[model samples]
Target: MRNLRLTLAWAAALLVAVSPLVNAQTTSEKNLKSDKKAAMSKETLPRPKVIIFDVNETLLDLAPLKSSVGKALNGREDLLPLWFSTMVHYSLVETLSDDYHSFGEIGTAALMMVAETQGIELSYDDAKTAIVTPLRSLPPHADVIEALKALKADGYKIVSLTNSSSVGVETQFKNAGLTEFFEKRYSVDSVKKFKPHPETYKMALADLGVKPEEALMVAAHAWDIAGADNVGLQTAFVARPGKTLYPNADKPDYVVNDLSELVKHLAATKTAQADTESDKTLAEQLAAQAAKSAKRFPESVRKVYAEGIETVRATQIEESAKQVGDAAIDAELTNWNGETVKLSELWSEGPVVLMWYRGGWCPYCNIQLRAMQQNLDKIENAGARLVVLTPELPEKAKETAATNNLDIVALHDNGSAVARKYGILFKLPAAIVPSYRDKLKLPEYNGNDAMELPLSATYVIDKSGTITYAFLDADYKKRAEPADVIEAVKAAAK
Candidate 1:
């Protein structure tokens, strides 16, 4: 009886000693859960120093390629999605099997697989030409350019991480008019792994000199976001149409319907974090500059400029150029002296520098004309003849040449037939037509009832009638630098 009582006393002592320790563990766990909840609900995340973008679907619109693929499949448009899914599936298979194949190869294989399933015969060459060729020339999403510009202005270093081969991405960006916005182009080719592979994201981080936490991966695919999240990087999911997040994957730090929405969210977050006084001062400065510029030009002229900027941004003018190294069309044009000259005839003598200008009324054109005149001697020394093409009438061309003292031939492209041949002619927007006709008397200068203009472009054509170099931009104010033009001429001469 004595021993039993001692044992009971010891048991009671042990319970008293363990009670506070158990309470402390429970309290600690509760605190951890509270902290996690706070993080999940946090309104602001630490801003990323670098933003890595996915190239396909996220930036470039692949919808146009769907039509080409569908046509190849006997107009079965429904097969496009299946083909794309198979391509992605096989790419992952390649990664998992420790093998490597170009994205183009995998895509072609996927096309063949889909064709076999449908009992359709498809040649590898035909499939690649029809489907993969279009991938190089996909157009950008409508909001991509503006959103990228905003992010750049807000001081974010943007880079592209794509599964495409290096040459493929280069051509893609060049054709999509998106090459200028990205700081660098990264391809999974270097690492031999497709995306969702940790190495692919790690390669981007290492190349960009950014820590995982300091970078944000922006993608349209939920798998991409989950991959980035797994590696400790922040993520923004752009929920493109017909896309959904992976049900089992961790949620991204931010989610938006599109890139434009993401830009707005980032802008708001930035404003919330920035110093109020500095932001106010910067805003006032911008407003003042805008007011000054608005007052400097007449209302009609301002409207024309505004409309021009908008139109050019919305149009795919950059890709309209005839591909480089193609034969230049043998276009007959009337010079200022009423003499007809064929482009081939000029090329037979030596290399030719062909330039397109708006008219004498345009200050930008005049600047470009004078700049070319200054480089005329150098052009001749490099064994090239300089010829300027204008849609203006012969009389207007003569006046422009005489006014600028330009000795180079100024050809009158009467109805912009030569420009049309070069695939650079575009009708003036309705919004700017009235200002051009009534305010600037454009019809009087061009001798035409219709308002049409060629894009401001310059080309260096070799003796073989091949276009060796081209500088084409829709913005009237941007012209090819004289030095670059001279260098191109010298290279063409060689």
Candidate 2:
């Protein structure tokens, strides 16, 4: 009862709504005291600072769990929010009682309680399976994958700090196709405590060998931000419901409306920092090379080295901004697929109609594919080979092709590496994050877990890789008409 009171007190103090949970472990109470002490050890380490993440309400999606409950309760869609509140409440109860309960158990208990509250009849086993299965396989928000990729590329070490057991978090990470992005996943089971507990946050930072000041904490819950702030970690709040404003005691350093906004903000920050560092490094390298050349030859080489440095700087700037040469007319992409057909090679044989699509999840791609299918005969008779290049996983790519009933070859362009080489690769905008999640509901990129976007382009390439005709659409929804490609093919053949 004391434990329950402490748990409720903590929840009420933080204005955190919560549900009930399973019993705690034998050693949890003793462990909690040690955690506070353990967290006080602020040691700095050698590697770049690690940013610790909160998993469920942070990186991983709880929407599936909530959605399932809402459906189970017959439009009492608010059941999930209530159940989640109880889950957190019980997690604290376990910690205070010096006990540890697996997140799965706590989740089960919470679901049963929520069901009882709603006067719904569900057997313990049935309720547990319904809630836990989806929780275990919960997807990450769409923006999460891309945001992590950008951070990884920018040299930030990423880790997940969650109240879920390590096994639970692992299952979730793997299921969400997010195993690669996280350098480490720490579960509260390690400390036998949940967040708002300074020890839990401390242990995570300690393991990563980063000072709290150097680390940033991101979560969709206000309690998480407040707890993180108490322990001195900078927090970014992602406004998940029932998590109100910080209690005036702990304020987040940044409050974003959604994961998309957080991702864009982080990307811009990293980019600016990178540009600054790159400029410094470039200046130093040029100066050192110039000095070496001056020492090597007092006459001719000095001017050459100076000229080389200038050329290098100019090259960098041009490469940064220069668009690819009319991609349809030049820069023929080689086809490595075993098939004897290549996009450019086909053009010389007759005419080649190439489509650059963003893979199957895109509504625009589907609409365009159906249109292309409608004009298959016209395309073929015009002496053109139709090919679609996408960054989908091979199986998914094949499935998408089969579903579209396409006669064209669906080529795999995994990593968008081919598109990048062609200067068609661009970072996805944060604005489109919801479009991918709530709208298109696409699977993440196979390699990086980031959302994939392609500039829907159609090209007519000749046998020599020279593009004869091209269409580039800035709006992904509107594709080049099959008639347009057919006309281009006929014109090229003539």
Candidate 3:
């Protein structure tokens, strides 16, 4: 009996010690399974041929609309988030109830709800006008246009699929100057459902004549990504500020902070698929050529070049200047003949190519001017005028034009005032000032004591006053190539 008791005691002790180990093993197995599931969930997918972009906050910026709403609400912009969330919620509610409401109407209703909750009086008509009008004129988010152009250049059929009404999307695209980027604009109203609904995504796929797996949906909203992923479409989630992917939804195939990163991802896939070494973008080719040319310069000259390149790299002029969608600022200046000319008058003829040059002294400027002169025929043929602006006085400007044998109109910006307005004027760096003052005599040529010069930036302005192409760099040697300028003009004319 004592042996039996000893054995039982031992068994009981063993059980106590091993119980925790068993529990730990079970927990470990569960964790392993969970991790494996997550890994599978995030498995990368193949690229898609067609890319569908989401409008409203995805591509178009809504901050201005928020401001307008805030003005209507006694300067309470904090209420915008609640209003937008409420609108999205009711949009889904309407979709689930087999009902249909235009996004604009939903926005108005949401605004009204917010006003009521805040105990503020807001008329329905005022709400509608405030919300809907801004919606129609919203500008695209930064990095949207360039990314879309990159994707399109890579042969992807880009389209916009939104919950907005057809007319609403049309006006939005038109006002945003994004109509040309999209091959087609789709509205969820056609399917009588809002996004995050499988039907809405499926409808877009059907309309594009693409299978769900063959198309990718790019959106700033997690719900949009979730809905597209649920319907078997590839998804790219653009995590705009304050946007997050839904934890419960399937992981998107790609996640980026903005459209520019998405474009880089897609462009890499395209570059991988190219069969030959010659299939490269113009920008890439130019960069390669510039690198090759840099090797030939003497060390002193190369140092200047390096400094210029570094300065340009440091200054994000391209981002700060009037970009593709911005209206070109009208400026008044005198032509080389001392006749006052306005930029608006130049645009009245056709598309205008506005260029800035340093002065008659800079070899780089002369090279660029002569190069542009060679392409003047092509520019004029494309229904565009090539107008050059220089800080040089009228006689010096005339000298530069005659020296290059250029027939293009040369304007004299006497005080660099017009250049400053375009965000292209900068004071000469201290290192370069001695050369300009002693060797170049820039003050005499430009007739300016300020020692300021405009960056040799070029812009292609369309007839609608929108700047379609802008090449602004602090490095004067990196002026826009004539061929690229011609291509830009052609695009503007189109």
Which model scores highest in lDDT? 1
Tens digit of per-residue lDDT, candidate 1, span 133-192? 789899999989999999888767789998899999999999988898999999999999
53, model 3: CA deviation in Å?
0.4
Off by over 4 Å in 3: 1-44, 270-494
TM-score comparison, 2 vs 3, better candidate: 3
Of 1 and 2, the candidate ahead on lDDT is 1
Q: What does candidate 3's lDDT look like per residue over 1-494, in tens digits?
A: 35535744654566566658645644533343344334335332334657999998999999999899998788999898889888887787676556788989989988987887777889999999889988899999989988888877766778999999999999999999999988989998788889877778878776665556558899999988877776667789999998998998667878999999998886565444332212443344345435534543446866875785577557776567777888899988878666888989888778999999888666567656766776678899999998888888888777666544467768888798888888887767667678678657878887867878888889999998999999987666577877788898999998
Model 1's lDDT to the true fold? 0.78
Q: Give every collision pair in model 3.
A: none
- Model 2 has how many clashing residue pairs? 15
The regions of model 2 sitting more than 4 angstroms off are 1-48, 71-75, 240-243, 267-494
lDDT of 1 at 449: 84
* Shift in Å, residue 379, candidate 1: 62
Which TM-score value belongs to model 3? 0.48
